[model samples]
Target: MITTDLNIKFYTYIYKCHPHLFSSLARDGQIMGLSLRVRRRGGSGSKKEIIPVTSCSEEVEITVPSQFQCPISYELMKDPVIIASGITYDRENIEKWFESGYQTCPVTNTVLTSLEQIPNHTIRRMIQGWCGSSLGGGIERIPTPRVPVTSHQVSEICGRLSAATWRGDYAACSEMVRKLKMLGKESERNRKCVKENGAGLVLCVCLDAFSENANASILLEEIVSVLTWMLPIGSEGQTKLTTTSSFNRLVELLRNGDQNAAFVIKELLELNVAHVHALTKINGVEEAFLKSLNRDSTCVNSLTSIHHMILTNQETVSRFLELDLVNTTVEMLVDSENSVCEKALTVLNAICETKEGREKVRRNELVIPILVKKILKITEKKDLVSVMWKICKSGDGYEVEEALRLGAFKKLVVMLQVGCGEGTKEKVTELLKMMNKVMKMNGFVDRSDSSSIEFKHVKKPF
Candidate 1:
C-alpha cells in the first residue's frame, strides 16, 4: 500500500504525482496562505514520512484595467491602489485606499498599506525630494534665473547642498544664492508646511555662509536660528548668553521681540548662567527703557516672562521697581479673560517671589487677601501654586488661617503630600503648621469641634 506521513503542508504547491494519484490534503493557518505535510510510500511504522512540499502566496502584480475608475473622483488613479485582501475588493474604489504617506485605512483604522509592501515606483519618485538627500549627498543642483530664495527655488538649493562642489568657492554658489533670493519672494505663496520649513533650511545655510564672513546685510535673526541648529554646540553651559562683543548686537536684536526679533531673543534666552549675567548687563538698557516708559500690560507681560531668567543685575531689579509693577498687576488678577488674566497673574507671581520683589514696594494689604480668596475659590492649575504660595506668605493677619478653612489645606497638601520633590513640599508643610498654630491661638478653631484643629503650640512642657 502506498502510504506516507507528511507534516503540515502549504495551501498551494507543486506536488509529486503517483500512479492512480491520491488526493491532496487541505491546508489551513492564520494567514490566507498554504503549508505542507508529507508521508512516505508504504514502509515500516518507524520514520515512514515523505519530505514536506513548499508553498507560496506571493502578491501577484497586475495591470490595472483602464476601465477601472475611482468611484469618488471618476478618474484614473493618480497612482495605483491596493484593495482589501478579504473584504469586497472593489476595483472602482481602489484609488481611495492609497494615500501618499499614511498607512492607516481611513475607514477601519486597520493598516492596509504597509510601507514595505508598496512597489509602485512612480508613486515613490513623485514625493522624493530631488535635492541630494542628507544621506550621501543625494541632492541634485538645478540652475535658475536670479531671484530671491523661496519655496519654488528650494528644490534647486537642496540639489546643490548634495553636490561635490557645494562650497562658497564654487561658481554654482552665487546662482544658488540668487535662486534662493527669488524663492524668498515666492515663499508667501508656498502653502505646505514642509516646503516652508525647507525654505527655512535654505535661508539657514545662506545665512551661515554670509555670517561666517560677517555678512552685514544678511538678516540677523535668521542666522541665529540657523546657528541654533547648525552652530557647534558648546559645553552644556558654555555658550555665551550676552557677549559684550555680541551684547550690543543682541540688544539691537531685542529692540523688540517683533516677528524679526523672536529668534535672536530666544538665543539670548538660551545663554548659560554666566551668559545670563551678561544678558542682565545688556538688558539693563531695556530695563531703563521699561522704567522710563509706561507700557500697558502687553509690554509688561512679554518682558516679565523672559526677564525672570535674568537674576543677576541690580539694574534689572531697579527697573522693575521703578515701574511699580506689583500694583499694576492687580487688574489682571481681577480680569475675566483667560490668557490675559493668566499672563498678568504670571508676571505678578514671578515678581512677588523674587528677593528683589520682596524689597520692592508691597501691594496694599487688601490685594493679597483678594488673590488668596481667588486662589481658594477656583480650580488650581500647577502653575498657579507658586503664585499662591508666594502671596500667602506675605498675607498679614487671619488671611492665612482663613485660607486653611477654605480648603487651602488640601491644596497645600496636594502640593506637599503628593508633590514630587523635598524642597517646596517641606517648605509648604512648615508654612501650613505655622499658620495652624497662629490660627488656633487667635481662636479661629473651636477647641471642642472635631475639625482636626488641634493647636499644640499653646501647650508647653514643664
Candidate 2:
C-alpha cells in the first residue's frame, strides 16, 4: 500500500510537469496497472481514468515474429508475396531483388522458375494482427496488397470481350471494357501491359460487332471511352477501325451524340490521313461534324477534324453541300471566335474545291460576304481568300458581281499588299481579276465610279 502511494505520487508529478511523455509511455504499454482518474485544467466536468504504469524493469520490447519478416529485407512484411521458390518476401523488396538481376530466392538460394509474385494473404493478415495488438496503433496500418496487373489478365479481358461480342452480350461487354479502363488508369505500366496484350484490337472488334445493335448504345459509349485511353493504336487495330463498315459505324455513334466516339474517330483519322477517304463515305459524317461544331465543348478539335477530312477527301464536299453545311458553316462564322472562324472557313474552302461545291456555296448569299469579312479579321487568310477565289472563279457571274458589291475587291488588294504567303497572294490576285472582269461585264467599265467598288470598307467586317 505504501509503495503504491509512492508510485501514484511519482506519476502525478510526471503528469503535472511532463504530461505528454507520460501519455506516450502509457500508450506504448510501457506502463500497466490500475486505473486512476485525473482532471485536466478547464475540464468539462468530466473525469477520465488513466492506467497506472508498472516500473521500468517490467517493460519488454515488442519484437516482430521472425516468420512475419520478409527474408529479402529482414523487415516486417507489409505486402507479403510468394515467388516460385515457395518463399515469401515483402512485394517491394522482392521486386527490387528480381529487377537487380537476381534469379534465385534470397533465402532458399533456389533458382526461381518464374518471377510472378502471388500475394500471401495468410501472412499479410497475420502480420496485420500482430502489428495492431503489439504496436498499440503507433505505426501505420498495412494496406491490403494490390496484385500487380499482368499481361495475362489483360489478354484474358480481351478474350472475354471477344467472346461477349460473339455472344452479343451488352452487359458482359460493358463490364469488361470498364474493367480494362480501370486497369489502364491505374498506372503507365498497366496501360502498356494492357495495350501490348491486344486490348485495343479487341475493343475495335467489339465496337464493330456492336455497331448495328441499337440496344447496345451504352456499351458502345463504354467501349469508345476506353479506346481514348488506348491511343496510338497498332496498324492492325487502325485498319480494323478504318474499314468501311466499322468506320461508318463509328460515325453513326457520333451522330447519336457519342462525343467519345467522335473523339476516337478524330484521333484515328489524325493517325492516318488515308482514313479520311473511309470517313467521307459515311453518309451521316458531315452532319455529325456539324452537330459537334455547334454543341460540343471541343468544337475546335471537331472543326479541325472535318477540315482535314475534306482536305484529304475532296469528294466529300458534295455530300457536305447536300447536307446544307454551306449555311451551317457560314452561320458558324458569324458568332464563332477567330480560331473557330478560321477552321469553318477552311471547311468551306475545301468544299469550294469541287464545281458543285462552289455553286452550292456561291448560291448562299452569306458565303461570299462572310469570306470577304474574314480576310483581314482572321490571322490566316489563305483559306479565306481561297474560298473567295473558288466561289468567284468561272462562275455564272453572280458570285463575282456579289463580291464587287460586298467590296471584296479592296480587301483582296489589302491582303495582297499585307504580304501574305505566295499561295494566298495568288488567290487574292485571281479574285481581284475575276471581280474586275465581272464589273466589266456589268457595264461598269464606262462608269468612272466603277473602280469605286474598291472602297476601303463596304459595311463592316463582321
Among these predictions, the greatest lDDT belongs to 2
Number of clashes recorded per candidate? 43, 0
**Which prediction has the highest TM-score against the true structure?**
2
Q: Model 2 segments beyond 4 Å from truth?
A: 1-153, 163-169, 185-193, 243-245, 270-274, 277-315, 395-418, 431-462
* Local accuracy by lDDT, each model: 0.43, 0.74
| Model 1 TM-score, 2 decimals | 0.43
Instruction: For candidate 1, write residues 245-339 as lDDT tens digits.
Output: 44455455445443233344444455445555655665455553343223344444344434454344444555666655555555445544545
TM-score per model over all chains: 0.43, 0.57
Give per-residue CA lDDT, model 2, range 196-300, as digits (tens). Answer: 888999998888887777777778778888888788798988887887777777777777777777778888878887887778777778888877765663466
